[model samples]
Target chain A: MNFIELTDQPIDVAKVLQSVSHPDAGGEVLFLGTTRQFTAYPDSKEQDRSGDAGGQHTAFLVYEAYREMALKQMERLAEQACQNWPLKSVALVHRLGKVMPQEASVAVAVSSPHREEAFQAAKWLIDSIKADVTIWKQENSPSEDAQWVHPTNSGAAHE
Target chain B: MIQIRLFAGATQLAGQSTVELSPTDLPTNPTVGDVANCLTARYPQLQSLAAKSRWAIGSEFVELDCPVESEHSLAMIPPVSGG
Candidate 1:
């Protein structure tokens, strides 16, 4: 059973793991991506060290996505990974809306005939999710200021 | 009319979830890039995000030169931050 879901509710890892459990699979890999307390943006202006460094204390994250697109992308990733690997089952879940720090935002679980394939598929799924998924997060400060997180260029700050 | 959905920073920059471009407002046949340009023209603040965003028709991503029609589902996909 391949599980693909996008929810505003907290992710149920037990169910995710259970979905990937198969008789033929000897190994299963589950990866949980949790929201961090602090978010440090990758500086594009690394050459100039005097600019505003982007290590901020993110109180929480507000996640939003193109819902239809996101689900389609998740389903596609699960299908592609299953075809690429000798896997038994897979589950991919991503959280939407407000997510607190230290909470699990994303989960990827895959079962395979061997540990190598499981690990590889799990990694690829997570990586692809980060790259192609339409989801975006807003970093909210302790004082409640919100800043949309995006890959920045030069030294300009996001509005 | 073709309503292009915007996400993430593009949404924030545009101050709206979607940008509406009427058929009469555009040329005879518009490409994905033309619609993108119309977006920036409509919302100047979205220049940076619009430039970086990828235009998608339905679930598949399309390049700038790809021809777009009003009936097709369109979306502006910003660089994703999801894990």
Candidate 2:
């Protein structure tokens, strides 16, 4: 079984866990994505737009998606995961609109009879969603300007 | 006319979410590549994203050479940044 949702409300991790939980499955993995407080603008000019040279703090993030295509792609990924692993259930949820700092924006849960398969499936699900889903995130800085983030460059600074 | 939907950076560059192209403006039974070429011709700013973007018919991604039916919805997808 699979559960896929694109919603404007915050992701409900508990509900996702409940949905993916199966009596026969001995292991389950859950991944949650939370909004970060700081983000650097890809372009230095955007930092100038904020007028604060020292630090560029993200005020919030606005997420948008090609909803129809996103759902279809997510479903396809879930099916692919099931085919590759000994999985019993999967749940994927993503939040749209404004997401505040430290709030849950995305959640994924997968269940399998063993820990290894569950771990692998969960990792694959999140990675595939990042690479394939038709969802976009625009970082809203303190200057009240929002810049669309590119997928390739979306990583932590220290990484 | 075939409607081309733009998303993410493509939408920002095009300055509009949707652009329409009449059948007369394209090759007969235009492939996705043909439609992409027409888009770049009309909106030169989109040229940079042409190679990076993926084309989707309805909800599924399609190859550049895939034929587009008149009634199908076409979307130009830039690299995704979702979690």
Candidate 3:
């Protein structure tokens, strides 16, 4: 019953945590991804070997996605996560538009009867979001290049 | 005619996000696959990306060949990198 699509805003993580907490839920897991100053140089072996300066300091990021479909994907992802784990509640929020370093980009919090299930399901949601959803990210790096990341044969931006 | 939309990079490639094209005029109501082919034909940059991209009928991701009626709002959704 909780899903959102929006630009930057003041987040209430504590509220989300409280909402999902229940007497039967013994463990809660949270995943927070802040904007790293540098883009995680993916394992592009050839790009690394070419030595085009591996540390690409990010200037800013442009995040975009197909909102309606992304929300639907999130629903499916949550369903899959819940199926895989005995979870009581799941809360996920993601930010879009230009975000600077050290800013929060996305967060996933899961409440379950145990910690392991919460942790595993949260991880799965984030990974599936990256691999499947039609969102795109364009990173403006100090390396003097801007790159667009997307899935092969897909239309979603890497937001 | 269905209203088709593109967003972000896909929009950039297409030069616009919303396009109204006649679906009934075609041999049959076009499918998501047909929309993709038409898009690629109009924008050559889409040729490579089309293989990986997906189409959405409303809130769900539908196969490229999923039949789309005239009133459906088809969307071209590229991958996103939101945290």
- In angstroms and one decimal each, the interface RMSD of every candidate reads 4.5, 3.8, 3.2
TM-score to native of every candidate shown: 0.91, 0.88, 0.83
- What shift in Å separates residue A49 of candidate 1 from its native position after superposition? 9.8
Candidate 3 structure quality by residue, lDDT tens digits, A1-159: 444344466356776677677788899888877776755454455355353544568887777767767777777777777787888888777677776777767778888998888888889888877777656677878665766666342234432
- Candidate 2 global lDDT: 0.85
- True C-alpha contacts between chains kept, each model in order: 0.72, 0.67, 0.61
Between the candidate structures 2 and 3, which one is better when assessed by TM-score? Answer: 2
Residue range B20-56, candidate 3, lDDT tens digits? 7776434576778887877677679877756666677
A152 in model 2: Cα distance from truth in Å?
4.7
Ordered from best to worst lDDT, the candidate numbers read 2, 1, 3
Model 1: per-residue Cα lDDT over B1-83, one tens digit each? 89888887777777788778997777778998888888888899988877677778987778889998889778987777887
- TM-score of candidate 3 against the unseen true structure: 0.83
Q: How is the predicted docking of candidate 3 categorized under the CAPRI scheme?
A: medium
| Model 3 bad stretches (over 4 Å) | A1-7, A40-55, A142-147, A151-159
Clash list (residue pairs), candidate 2: none
**Local accuracy of candidate 1 as per-residue lDDT tens digits, A1-159:** 699999999999999999999999999999999987866654636644344455678899999988888899899889999899988999999999999998999999999989999999999999888877888888899999898777654112221
